[model samples]
Target: MSANEVFLVAMLIIFSLPWLVWRLCRTDYFAPLVVVQIVMGILLGPGVLGRWFPDYHAWVFAPPVVQALNGLALWAVMLFVMIAGTELDLGQAWRHRRESGITAGLALGVPLLLGCAAAGVLLHLPGWVGEAAQGWQFVLGIGMACAVTALPILILLMEKLQLLRQPLGQRILRYASLDDIAVWGLLALILMDWNRVGRQALFLAGFALAAWGFRRLMVRLPEADRWHVALIWLALCGFTADWAGLHYMVGAFLAGAVLEAAWFDQARLDQLRHHVLLVLMPVFFLSTGLRTGWSVGGGEVFAAAALLLGATVAGKLLGVHLAGRVLGWPACEAPIIGWLLQTKALIMIIFANILLDRQIITSASFTALLLMAVASTMLTTPMVAPRLANRRAP
Candidate 1:
């Protein structure tokens, strides 16, 4: 077959199989279609499908086909991250500064501390840390991974629960928004290259100037024109960030972060996000799955996943409960908030992908983190639905 033919076939399999399974199994109550696609990616990866059906795997995911899919995945994730950045309502967060700050801080901090402790334990065991990792890089990377809340996924869950536009849902977004800032800031710190420090500094300075001028230009343009201009700006920022030895994803986030969300129509923006998720992100999920490894043993990877899941879930609940006490929130609020914030499917996976790309974490560690993310995401709706059903809204 021609490469294009094979690539099309592969793409067909990528999109069809997940939807088929998701439809047949009816897993939406627990595992959303997105989560199922991620799981399907893992099953189709080298660790599972390749091991069992090596010849078929090799034929379907041939080098050229994989490369084609990777290009799609790269652009998909870049746009997804940019949209995530654009959605950051820091103005809303700032309006509720005290409540937002306290919740966001504790929600992020407690997991970080516990996750660091878990990292310390993992360090003692070989094959869990990456070859290029420094003691601090591995420790901090894993810690932040645990602390991450998948903002995109959180928004989806809230929409599913019919609380998306409610005051409660808006409040959750505020907390997640603040933590999103912290997550990216820490990632920048972790990814800092001493040898390329000058370039990094130049990138930041250049970005600031470009962002200011771009914002001015965006404000002047009509909304329709703004969309095209934003894509152009996304490419520029991504290219510059990659040139500076920071990741393109970071640059994509910055590109959107500097702009006002008010510049775009909210309904249209939401539709764009849904379209991206439906059409592009499954390829990203497949590419992510292709990277999963079991070199350290499946049992060990799963064991580590369980440990990290416990740390993440427990830490989030404990932290949010404490925040509730400090902020004088209603009694019914914290549990729902904690369970909702524990959604870590997409953003955590993105964070881990960057870590793996930087060689700060090995494939084994990435696999473990991937499992934890999947489990935590699966737990969110089932756990929160029951709690929210029982409790009265504040």
Candidate 2:
């Protein structure tokens, strides 16, 4: 809105981008780009001085600035998600599909079901109040949130550890990626239900068909001309989707899925990824870091926050374990898949923001849920997949 506000926002990005890149370039260990940006965000936010200097935070990470920075980040995120969707090869797992399907179902369905039940129980706790905080509402939201499997994180870590090329890595990544897409579809459905709109499902189905049709048409276009205006179209779609009551993410994500280069065109896909990953995605992750107000923690809020954290971790472990056995996830693959699919990331930030927006969940609850998500992701995803591979091997 004002020149000073605009200047502060730019400074945040300028500081964060290089900090993360430097960390990522120096060593692959502690600092992949996302983790670095997250750290940068913490240092820059209320977590540190925003904690120490309350007035500085109020003056700096203002509501308008947060919105503006996050808005800039959205495109990069959509690009990343789209690249993820496009990279999926249903055929890779088609042979193993039957077994992997069982593993994936346990990974997805079990967590989802259990997450809901966990929420139901948690919400009824005495004196708890929330937006979508009632029995069924709470249950369903937690279940799906617990069910979330972070595909991008999985791929990033796998690549970093050189696990992507391994058999276990391949099986896990392929299955996780496909299942991630499926889960997003389910999330979209939950949103439709949340909005009390039955027609959105049909609208999405039609959107899928249209994407397929457009993708088919794009293949016939001259190579350079095909991708030239793709980002423009996607941004336009994102704005339209947001205005239409469906989250901008639905359109943004689906646009990525639709425009993605298919299986045979690996080179083009790789080139496309270079642009989205190094450029856009970092912006998105950094923006997310900036948007989170770590300084908002309060006393009563912490207990509820703690409950959310506990529920999140316990829900995923139990949910995934239950489905792992029932779906016949090869004992090794099942537990591993359970952990992999259970990791949550920025999605919780969105959910927490939704609660915050409605004044349902306290700022502390938002902080706690986000912490739960990050902690769960860091703890579960990094170690579980590789270890499972070792155990499963003959």
Write one digit per residue (lDDT tens) for candidate 1, span 104-153: 99999999989989999998899988877898999999999999999999
Per-candidate count of clashing residue pairs (backbone under 3 Å): 0, 4
When superposed on Cα atoms, how far off is each prediction in RMSD? 1.0, 4.4
Give all candidates' CA lDDT scores. Answer: 0.93, 0.60
lDDT of 2 by residue, 1-394 (tens): 5857665665666566566576657733433555555445545556555678887666666777667667666666666656666666677768787766766665667556655665565565533335544445445655666666666666666676566778867887666766667766665554554453645655566676767777777778776666665666577556756655566666776776666555236677667777666665555555555544534345544554455556656655665576556655556655565565556665555554444444444444455556666666666644574665587579
The stretch of ten residues in a row with the least summed lDDT in candidate 1 is: 385-394
Name model 2 segments beyond 4 Å from true.
Answer: 1-31, 42-51, 62-64, 125-135, 193-202, 205-209, 263-278, 289-337, 346-362, 380-382, 385-394
Candidate 2, residue 386: the lDDT equals: 66
TM-score of 1: 0.99
Task: Score residue 59 of candidate 2 by CA lDDT.
Answer: 68
Q: For every model shown, what is its TM-score relative to the native structure?
A: 0.99, 0.77
Output the lDDT of residue 278, model 2: 63
lDDT score of model 2? 0.60
